[model samples]
Target: MKKIVSLLLTATMVLGLAACGNTDEETPETPETPGEEETLTGTGEGYGGEVTVTVTMDGDTITNVVAEGPDETDGVGTPALEQLPEKFVEANSADVDVIAGATVTSRGLIYAMKNALDPDANPWPMVEEEEDPSNVEASDVALGFGISSLGRKGPGADDTETQVWSINEVLASALFDGEGKIIYLNVDQVEVATPNYDGEGMPHLSGWPGQGGYNIDEDHDEKVDGVTEDTEENFIAEVELWKTKRERGDDYKMGISTWSEQMDAYEETFVGMTVEEIEEWFEKYTSDRNGRPLKEGSEDAEDKAKYDALSAEDKEMLADVTTSATMSLNDSHGNIIEAIRKAYENRMGLEITEAEAAGFGVSFMPRIGPGKDDQDVQVYSLNQVFANTLFDEEGRVVAIHVDQLEVASPNYDGAGMPHFSGFPGQGGYNYDEDHDEKVDGKTEDTEENFFSEIESWMTKRERGDDYKMGISTWAEQMDGYEEVFIGKTVEEIEEWFDKYTSDRNGRALKDGSEDAEDKAKYDALSDEEKAMLADVTASATMSLNDAHGDIIKAIRASFENREVINLSVN
Candidate 1:
């Protein structure tokens, strides 16, 4: 019976292929011309352009299938196009799952293949039904954070300099109701940079030693002779501007009426709407259904007519908020949907274990450097620490573990002279492993010990080069600091950080000061260790403050909004 079914399917495919000629209209099958392989071609509309598929068949079995969609997004759609042809040949049918996230492109390729193999037949697969959020009954808030860093290893030359590193961090949170409806959404993004270093790892002013050199004036409009309080003030103002843009609405100057209209349209389209419904609405705006560009004021009359006919809700979904504020409503909607899904799971009394409730914290050394060349080479030793805290259902931390990584370019020795060889050649230490278990009789390696290791490493790399200053690793300092954070609520952590990390003067809380206990461990280090500690303590304090501070802020913001919603409901 299986064999009979297979024969019948093969016969059906042959007849279908014969009907699918070069054009849509049926053409008589040509007798085999000398040295010509049987090939059929078809095209289907894709996300950005048409996707074409060519199929070559030997009798009833498909020998080859080639699909191409050049206009599609490279990482998202190209992968689907590259892999789907093989899938079709293996299955001998176009019935397959669309590549996750690249649905439109995958559908286009599949439709093209179906047209090539069987234009007259209904070879398209049935659309998957979206989960109905209306029936979902439980809701909870979930926060998601992502951090990415990019670095380049380079040696500076007389004519060129390298941008050593940069980091970008994003934090997003959403609140979902019992029905899996997103009630609130927020996102914050921050970026920081490291200084450019020379061949021997010595820090240099980028574009220095010339008129109109590297330093910027108060306005940051052009280079200046020197930096002053104004430079710091200006830099702070720029950071504030970036933060505002991320936290609030975009800074673009749209007409007040237009802005109000867009806001009203968004509220009408999305408020109290389920994720599925919101997605369907966005699809309409994104789709080129009438074979016309969906942008406002399209040149094509039909396209312009279609745009004009769209409801205000559709227009708002398609609206572009200036070139700089280019994030699409579709992207924001997706995030809200994910948050809703997570909230729905939590409301359903899903057993979320300690591992599932665990939160991760990350801290980078020198969180905000004075814009590259503001500090000396020795101060450039950078470290990143990632810590995860597993929490019980009661929201108490059950377990905590930390891993740290550090990198340093070449730097000046104790004499304030550049090292002969920089970075990869001088080689930095991995404090996580290469340090002594016990230093100066303190037992477990601490920040002072880590700094001692760094000094020793730096000293040995260049003979006669000594770093006699007091040294303190951010990790060692954070060891005691971490204790203050453990078992505390995120809000408590934020309060503690704001009060204890820095003094009234904005310096690291010193040994014998109000937060002396945290500093006492460092004070016990040798005279040289104390001196080495001086340069980094302030920067490390600021860095630690920013890293943990941001996480706490994100959590606090999420819960605060959650509370507001609950109050309104009550």
Candidate 2:
């Protein structure tokens, strides 16, 4: 009876509409069936995984959206997922403002939404016309980046002292005005183990995480403190978890203020000064012990009190800066001043008007050369790559700064200058020319060189000509390679690497390789390919992906994770 009543009502409504139209062939456009809502779903690729977008639409307008990308990074991608869904609804369109430091995830969410709304209309790979860079005004400002490392001793197994490699970096582009004054800066710090660093350093596999992960149950896969199984997965996981002190943000407890807050205070204090002036300012006001601003009022008997003591005028000059950043920016903490000074040395012509973004990246990988060697003589090597890039609004690289560092255990030096390949529990020897015997850097520890050897892990850029790479220094070659990176997109840079590099060893295709396979591969390449990379090979012939460094990975990541900023070009 209810179905018959509904059929009668529907027929009556149709008859009324037909009477108003006065035509049998006329049909009315149904408006979303009145009070009915439609749900849609779409997916797109994210940084480390896939992003799925679900939306409920009220007619043609987006009423609600939910984006999920569980595999995205904790601080980067997760934030985007939690934040962008609301923005999608507010905009009522797939196009929305991008979240800073998560460009890859932003694209994922946008594309997913586009497909969800109308896959047929929007297409899977929607292309948009790019705004020409020439149409935008050329910028007058330049930018730079830097990282520095100093080592110290910390507690090891039981109560013994182990080497702790302290590393600090400033990414920032240190946006400079035409007069060469700094207008912007971004700083962060991370320390790595020099054999076995304390819990304060980078996410060390065998040192801290290994110790904890080893005890965390059967499901964990890390190589625990020299006991668990070692694999590439373990190292990669460690790298993935590593974060700078600034990235740690509020998690890096400082009692009075966060690490980022302290750095921000200092960054603000240093702006408007040239690098030379900054050095002069540091020389006059910073504490010798902790690198904080000199204080005038503390009278306690501690070493810090003595370091903090200052005269009236000197303290007055630093009065403004001292209040906000009382913590150390030194080896005791993070050497931000030194990093900035080094940054000035590496400045490049990167013009950007309020529309560009910058990013800093470091590729750290542990290298263990397997096969062939005595168990009595071996050491560990840590290769680190640091890069800072400025990206145009069109997503092309505007400028870049890159440098690399290789640090080894003291025992590595004992092996030889070029190589100390062995398989073991031993330190190399230093030769005594007059005595014609193996000296200190010897198997046993000496009073003088023990502390000295542990505290000096220098970067290649600092070593300069000393880090000889055939006819060019490591710094010179790195600069040359950076020129090739400029003006290309990240995709282009990656494709260039694939085209010019050797798959076997991950280096440029060279004629003088020790391996016959590499030689054959180089010979097999067409003349066009060889000529394409000729300019690069002339300066940088070393492997970009081998044990030396992982530069391409760093380059890609710099773009993947960038912070958005705005400032007039000079």
Candidate 3:
């Protein structure tokens, strides 16, 4: 199969409210330092014209705030000018609620007041009260990954929009509150073939990264990684660098806000909601066909019906949701709500704090190199893996999960899957090692046989003792690595990999290569490094990157993808 893996959500850290903090520094151009009482006047742009404010400060207290804008709209800007001054005087700060129908006027008045108070600040920013997570994992918390498809849209007949098939991967991650509610949620999606999807709307990806032809690279020839053909290798090479919606941040623009910002808005709305509640909310608020919130004044019959059906209170609620997010939550764009449901199903409890963080990632690879070298008897295997993590406020990995599923041709199953030649399913034949033949029970390869084994797609953990690693099962060793990673940060894990794993293959240092250089590197390890290396061998001996999978990459991304959550341990 091709590399049609689902997308992943990552975050760019957000700025806090330090901009709203009180400052003792005198205004940059204040004429003189006022001792007990001082009056300062400032002006700002309103909906119709300039709005002005004069602040009267008595010592540290705001004694009065007066705002005026003569050309402003009578009913809209007038009420804001008359009412917001008193609000500012009572609050003593420009950060407050925006007047419902007089947003521009209220904002202008607030900006003028802020200017009168400091003379050196931008008009008050439209800031929301966001609780960014400093921590994410608590004992009761769980991190999950949910993926869905947008199906596929045509390289359509429409000329107005670009003609291309879009193969989509919508992904969601959530921090579960352990009380059946989601504490934090992150969502993102990727459309693989924006301009060049196959006729069937399946993926026709090459090593090209963008709509503009392929990028030249040192490793890749011709175009992407230098390959001359559109093969699995070419696809893998291309997708490794692809960015999801959240990962693209500001570059992936939507309407007024970036994709990440809008997704953040949707994510915040999901907090404290159960999976069922979220589904109901999506169905009730969003359009039945497109999954977009109804516009208040839309003349379309369906939209008007939805708009009219909403109670006055629900209308306000819908307005609050649409202000920051208007992207379709499901339908052709992406089935985000379905992903959330999957996340709840996949949830695994961990001990973490709401102030901490959690993240999810997957690494995929297709291996078909020469191991048991035979021209016709070559092996092909595909590995897709996951290693999500939980972190404390200071970024220590508190919980780590490592699991994988390896599917391969019957001739070549790695340590994770044992290969028995000549079989439709279970094998009872013994192999003649010297003669290179099978003896006893006979089996043949056929379409029926191949189709029959479809149910044989088993996970490493599901394989249990069948997945032999000589010293232990694959699951046991992976578990041991998880133990090694506990309490370690991403940095520490990287350092550990550098010290103990072989640089060439990413396997445990000496197992894959014990050459002179490898021996020298191993011998030069400090005592602590050597001890840690020796200890880890008891559990695992697999590469985190080489032919196996990108476990390290997944872990690092999990850290980079951390976001604030509302989990509670107690």
User: What TM-score against the true fold does each predicted structure earn?
Assistant: 0.31, 0.57, 0.60
Error of 3 at 454 (Å): 16
| TM-score sort, best first | 3, 2, 1
Q: Give one digit per residue, the lDDT tens place, for model 1 in 128-191.
A: 4554332212334232222222222322221223223223333223334445565443333333
Q: How do the residues 1-570 of candidate 2 rate in per-residue lDDT, one tens digit apiece?
A: 644876798899889886887666757576645546899998886666678899998766689998999877778677779899999999999889766546567778888998887798756555565543322222567777666554333322312322333334333347666677887677777743333442443444432211122211122232124332344456455645666665565546442345676677777778888878877777667766556666655453453464455566655666656544567766544466777876777677654444477777777776653211233333445577878787877777877778776754333422222221111122333222232222233433332343344334456776766777675888888887888888899899888787778887777787677788777877888888778667678887777787666899888877876655545463
- Candidate maximizing TM-score: 3
Q: Which window of 10 residues has the lowest lDDT sum in candidate 1? A: 202-211
State in Å the error of residue 519, model 2: 7.8
Best by lDDT: 3
Q: How much does candidate 3 score in TM-score?
A: 0.60
CA shift of 488, model 2, Å: 1.2
- Overall lDDT per candidate, in order of appearance: 0.42, 0.62, 0.63
What candidate 2 gets wrong by more than 4 Å, as runs, is 1-143, 154-178, 193-202, 205-242, 247-250, 279-289, 293-324, 346-355, 369-376, 410-451, 510-527, 565-570
Model 2 earns a TM-score of 0.57
Query: What local lDDT score does residue 535 receive in model 1, on the 0 to 100 scale?
Result: 44
